[model samples]
Target: MAMTIALNKAGKRFNRDWIFRNLTFQFESGNSYAIIGSNGSGKSTFLQVISGAYHLNEGHCTWTDGATLPVEKVYRHIAYCAPYLELIEEMTLLEFLEFHQHFKPFVAGMTPKKIIEEIGMQAAAHKRIQQFSSGMKQRAKLAQCIYSDVPVLLLDEPCTNLDRQGIDLYYTLIDQYAKNRLVLVGSNDEVEYKFCTQRLNIMDYKSF
Candidate 1:
C-alpha cells in the first residue's frame, strides 16, 4: 500500500511566537525529502508534526494509506530517530532490539542478530546501553529506526554523535533500507540528506 502525508496550512507556536505558519505540503511514499533550516528554525518541529509526535498549533496534518488513517495509529507506521530521543539505558543492546520487536517488527528478514552485526555492536550486544559511548548509542538508535518495518521514516540530526566511520554506517544503512519508503530528514548538512530528491526549507514557510 502507498502511504501519503498531507499538511494543510500547518503551523506551530510556542506561546505568542509562531514557529512556522500556513505551511502546506504533501509527502508520498517511495520518495525521500530533506527539511533544511538554520539551527533555530523549525525543521525538527515540522518533522515531529508530520510524524504525529506533536500536534499542529493551527490547521492539520493527515496520514493516508489508500485511505485516511487515524492520527493515533500513525506511530505504528512510522520509524523516527532524533538526537533528542532517548534509548532505554537499562536495557542491553540485544534486549532493547528484542523488546522493540514486540511493538514494531523489523523490516523483512532483519533480525536482532542481524541488526547488532550490521551496527558493528556484536561485542557489546550484552552490554547495557548506559555503558555505551555516545556514538554507539547513536548507532543503536539509527539501527532501530532503519531496521523497522515501517512506511515512514523521520530522521532529525541523525549524525549528531557519529564519527567518520559511524557516518559511513549511517549511509550504508539508509542505502539498504530506505527504498520505497517515505524518508524525511531534518538537517542542514548536505551529507546527511544527499539522497533526498526534494528539499524543503522551513524558513521559507515562516511568517513574521
Candidate 2:
C-alpha cells in the first residue's frame, strides 16, 4: 500500500515568532525529498512536523496508508536520525541494537551482528558506544536509522561526522536500503541530499 504525509496550512511558532507558516504539501512514498536551509532555519522543526514529533499551531497534518493512521502510532512506521538524538552510551553497539529491536525490528534477515558488520564496525560490536570515535558513533547511528524496516525515513544532518569513506558508505546504504520508501533528508549540503529528486528550500516556505 502507498503511504502519504500531508500538511494543510500548517504553522508553528516559538515565543511569538513563526518559524514557518501557511505551508501546504504532501509527501508521497517512493520518493526522496530534501529540506534545505541554513542552521536554525527550522529545517529540523519541519521534519519533526512530518514525523509527528511536534504538533501544528494553525493547521493540520495527517498520515495515510490505505487509511488514516493515528498520531500515536506514527512512530512505529518511521525511522529517524538526527544529530541531536543521542544513543544510549552505556550500551555496547550490539547491546544497543538488541535493545532497539525490541521496539523496532531491523530489516528482514538482519541481526544485530549483521547490522554492525554491514557498517564495518564488527570489531567494535561489543564495545560500549561511548568508547566509539565520533565517526564510528555516527556509523552506529546510520546503521540503526537506515537499516530499520520502516516506510518513512527521516534524516537530519546525516553525514555530520562522516569522512570521505563514511560518506561513500552512507550513499551506498541509502541506495540499497531506501528503495520504495519515503525518505526525507534535512540539510543544506548538496552532498547530503544529492540523490533526492524533490527539494523544498526552507526559505521559500518562511511566510509569517
Candidate 3:
C-alpha cells in the first residue's frame, strides 16, 4: 500500500473568510476519491491547492512516496482537468494537444491521434478550438488530460457541458485510466460519486 497524497493541517483563506482550516487527510494510491460539497465549499480551491495550482495559505501538501522530488517534479505525475479552465482558443485541437505534450516527459508512446479517436473528436481535431461547441471543447480538453499518462488525475466538475453519452465516456475512461493511480473528483452528481472507492464530504471548514 502506497500513500499518494497527504493534506496536513491545510488551510486556505480569502479575505477574512476561511475556506478551510485545519483540514487533514491522506489519499492512498490505487484508489479513487470523490469530494462532495455544496457550491462555494472551496472544492475547486482545495483541488487547486492539491494540484499545486495555488499555494496554501497554511500547512502543507505533500506526496509521501515515490522518489523524493520537488513540488514541480512531483507535479509531472499529476494530470488536472476542470470545467473552469478553458482550452487555447487560438490553436486547433491537434495543435493544442501537441503544445501540452511538451510538458509531459512520460508520454512517449501516447499520441493525440488515438486519443482523438477515443474521445470522438477525430473529425474536429483540425478545427480551431474557438469554433467548437461547449461539448466538443470539453471532449477535446478531456482527451488532452488523459493523454498525459500521469499517475494522478484531479477532476473538478468533470461532467459539465457533457451530454448523456459524453458523460458515459467520462466514466469509462476513469475506470480504465485510474488503475493504480490516485483520482480525485470534485462533484455534486450522485452518479459520479458511485464510481469513487472513497468519499470525503467537506462541510463548513470554518466551523472546525
Candidate 4:
C-alpha cells in the first residue's frame, strides 16, 4: 500500500509568536522532498508537525494508506532523525539497536550485525554511545532512521556532525534504502538535499 501525508491549512505558533501559517502540502510515497529555510525559520517545526511529533495550532495533518489513519497510529509509519534527538548514552551500539528493534523493526534483510557492518562501526558495537565521536554518533542515528521499515522518513539536519566520509556514506545509504519512501529532509545546505526533486521553502509559508 502507498503511504501519503497531507497538511491542510496547517499553522503553528508559540506563545503569540507565529512560526508559519496556512501551510498546505502533500507528500506521496516514492518521492523525496527538501524543506529549506534559514536558522529560526521554522523548518524543524514544520518537519515535526509532519512527523506527528507536534500538533498544529490552527490546522490538521493527516496520514493515509488506503484510508485515513488515526493520529496515534501515524508514528508507526514514520522514522525520524534529528540532530537534537537524544540517544541512550548508556547503551552500547548493539544494545541500542536491539532496543530499537523491539519497537520499530528494521527493513527486510537488515539485522543488528548487518547494521554494524553497514555503518562501519563493528569494532565499537559493544561500546557505549557516550564513547562515540560526534561523527560516529551521527552515523548511528542515520543508520537507525534509514534502516527502519517505515514509509515516511523525516530527517532534520541529517549531516549535522558528519565528515566527508560520513556524508558519502549517508548518500550511499539513501540510494540503497530510501528509495520508494516518502523522504523529507530539513536542511539549509544544498549538499544535504541535492537528491530531492521537490523543495518546500518554509519562509514562503510564514505569515509573520
Error of 1 at 15 (Å): 0.9
Model 4, span 130-193: residue lDDT tens = 9999999999899889999999999999999899999999999999998889999999999999
Model 2 lDDT per residue over 39-103, tens place: 89999999998889898889999999989999999999999998899999999999999999999
The stretch of ten residues in a row with the least summed lDDT in candidate 3 is 105-114
CA-lDDT, candidates in order: 0.93, 0.91, 0.79, 0.92
> Which parts of model 3 have CA positions greater than 4 angstroms off?
1-3, 105-109
Task: Name the better of 1 and 4 by lDDT.
Answer: 1
Question: Which 10-residue window of candidate 1 scores lowest in summed lDDT?
Answer: 44-53
- Clashes in candidate 1: how many? 0
Give the distance in Å from residue 39's predicted Cα in candidate 3 to where it truly belongs.
Answer: 0.6
TM-score of 4: 0.98
Clashing pairs in 4: none
Give the C-alpha lDDT of model 3.
Answer: 0.79
Q: Work out the TM-score per prediction.
A: 0.98, 0.98, 0.91, 0.98
